[model samples]
Target: MATLEIRDLHVSIDTDQGAKEILRGVDLTINEGEIHAIMGPNGSGKSTLAYTIAGHPRYTVDSGSITLDGEDVLAMSVDERAKAGLFLAMQYPVEIPGVTVSNFLRTAKTALDGEAPPLRAWVKDLKSSMEALRMDRGFAERNVNEGFSGGEKKRHEIVQLELLKPKFAVLDETDSGLDVDALKIVSEGVNRVKESTGLGVLLITHYTRILRYIKPDFVHVFVEGRIAEQGGAELADRLENEGYDRFVTSTPVA
Candidate 1:
């Protein structure tokens, strides 16, 4: 089974004033078919952890190690990481003005698999996946996220997740800006992918609404760049009612 391991990870970023530490010392392990939900208040370094794992240049790893199935993830470049079965769905999906959605997805699939999929099979799969996500057929012809709505962009991200079938996915605030109906549809898509592929997930969010559909196996409360508490799905229920007030007050200012 595939496993992503993070050990005492410390990350920092350069700023106008000075260097600022983000992830203090995060240690977690996600195996295939497991879902880990990370819930925290704003500015608690949640997105920093996601970006660091994805090998973002802006976030510097100060210490510790990240390994994927015994391979050193920290040593791999961003694309190399993706090729190794790591995927990150960004909070704000970027627009590729000239590339059509179909072309971009196929190119990515070809790169990851090291062989171009058969044209007929690829087209059929693309059409089916889009229809399942309730995306119109014309979306395949349009430029990637060029004129798409927020919900459309999010659904497109799920389309990539389903088609790419990565070993692990780090979703950074995917539920943000989505309405109730859109949220359920996106969450259902994620669930379907996980069930089919045994895909591991590290879901980051502030509210518990998405949890109603995704149903995390483990719930981790992130406070001031560190995980303060962890438990089973029941933890999410407590968080939904209690919020992160207790954790916020306990964390020291930087």
Candidate 2:
């Protein structure tokens, strides 16, 4: 089984004053077919971990290492990380103006696989995934994320998840801004991928609602830029009831 491991990870970002540390010595190991839910308050560096794993240039890894199946992940470029089977669904997905959704996905899949997918198979999979997400057929022709509502953007991300079939997916606050119906739909899409591909999920969210559907195998409580506590699904229920007062201290940064 493939494994993604991070040890003694220390990340810092530049601000007006100086470089501010976000992740302080985080150690996590996720194996194939395991769903790990990372829950914490805003500014706890939850999203920072996601971005860092995706090789986002804004966050600097000051020390420690990240490895995928013993391969040095930090040395790989951003796109290289994706081709190596790491996928990130951002909290705020960016718009790619002038690029149609169909073209962008096909291009991304082609880049990752080193060859374009067969035209017939690609179109069939695209249509099927979109229907499963309740997205309109016309969305395939629309510019990627152009004029899309928050919910629509999220659904589009899941469609990519199902089609691309990455080994591991870092979903950063995918439940945010989604209504109850949309949330269930999106959650089902994720669950479907897990069932089909045994995808490892690093799901980052502040709310417990999504947890009801995703059903993580491990619940990690992130506080002050590190994982302060961890447990099973019961831990998530405790969080919903008692909140993060026991874990939070000092100031927080985004």
Candidate 3:
């Protein structure tokens, strides 16, 4: 039931001299059940766009607005944004030294649902979801992402997605550092979530490997902090074959 609307979103980071702009006027709208893939070069501000939408505190919004279900999201705090149904799977999963996966998941579930699910039911659901993602049972007992492998961390994020069932999710480079098998498993988990929950996805990545398993509804080429071109899933294929040089070099700077 959430509609994500971004209009001319411009973001900058504070520096000693002044602010250095990253995202330059990005405009996008994602409906409840659509998958939109954003592919860009290294400094194209792909992650910046994702973090900005999820209400990260580091980046400052210089202009434009982000709305969720007709409510102004930029006005909401990070906690309020999550409570309002926006989720972000970070590229670099954070390490929580004292928080076990089960505990963190339970806390998130409680926060989102406004009540704690019984321990028995929570464990049952957790085990089932972990199995579905081909994760080990030991994962639940370990501190969240403290010493997890690249694949394990990524899978854990997917587990959070399954448990949270967020309306809108921004997957920021989830494919990074994943092996071939890991990539397939991650993509499968993402596809399962989209199919079962009707969740809207804004997948941001630099590579096309992940797109093979989870075909995007739309693909946008991001260059120099702005979207240069957009097309169907075939655009991903084209980029894979031709590379982003042509797109990036030809794109005008903001």
Candidate 4:
């Protein structure tokens, strides 16, 4: 079984005001087939943790260790990290204006596997995954995320996740801006991928609504760049009712 481990991670960003630390000694572990939900208020460094794991150039890991199994993830390049089975579904997926969805998926798959997937099998898998995500077949010819709705973009991200079959995925606020129906559909897509591939998930969200559909084995409360508390799925219920008021002094954006 594969495992991702983050130990005392400290990350910073270069702002106009110089380097400002975002993650302060964060630590966590995710084993294969485990779903870990990280719920927190705004500016709690939840997204920072996700970006750090995905090897985003904006975030600087000053002192820490990120490892997949025994391999050092911190030392790997961004594409190298993806090849090592670490995937990040960004909060705002960028629009690739010139790249069609089919081309982008195939290119990414080829890069990760070090070989081109046979055209017939690749097309079959792509069509099947898009159908499961309720994506229109026409999307295959459309430029990636070009003029797509928020839900559509999120669904496309899941399509990548399903097709790529990553060992671990860091979903950053995937539930954001999704309507009730869209949320259910997207959540089901994630659950289906996990069931089929035993994919480990580190889901970051501000509400418990998504948790109801994608039940996490562990719930972590992130406060001020650190994990303030941790518990089982029941912890999400408490957050739904009580919120993070007791954890922090100010009212956090839910």
Q: Which candidate comes out best when scored by lDDT?
A: 2
Kindly list the per-residue Cα lDDT of model 3 for residues 1-254, writing each as its tens digit.
Answer: 76899999999988797888888889898998899999977878888898998888899999999999999999999989999989999999999999999999999999988999999988999999999999999999999999899999999999999988999999999999999999999899898998998999999998888998888999999998888899999999999888788877644332
Residues 18-110, model 4: lDDT tens digits:
898888889899999999999988888899899999988998899989999999999999999999999999999999999999999999999
Q: What is every candidate's alpha-carbon RMSD to the true fold?
A: 1.3, 0.7, 1.8, 1.7
* Candidate lDDT values, in order: 0.94, 0.96, 0.91, 0.94
Number of clashes in model 4? 0
Cα lDDT over the full model 3:
0.91
lDDT at 86, model 1:
96
User: Measured by TM-score, how close is model 3 to the native structure?
Assistant: 0.96
Structural similarity to truth (TM-score) of each candidate: 0.97, 0.99, 0.96, 0.97
Q: Candidates ranked by lDDT, best first?
A: 2, 1, 4, 3
**Model 1: residues >4 Å from true position, as ranges?**
250-254
Q: Write the per-residue lDDT of candidate 2 for residues 37-126, one digit (tens) a residue.
A: 999988999999999999999999999999999999999999989989999999999999999999999999999999999999999999
Candidate numbers, best TM-score first, in rank order:
2, 1, 4, 3
Q: Which of candidates 1 and 2 is the stronger one according to TM-score?
A: 2
Task: Give per-residue lDDT, candidate 3, residue 196.
Answer: 92
Clashing pairs for predicted structure model 3, backbone only? none
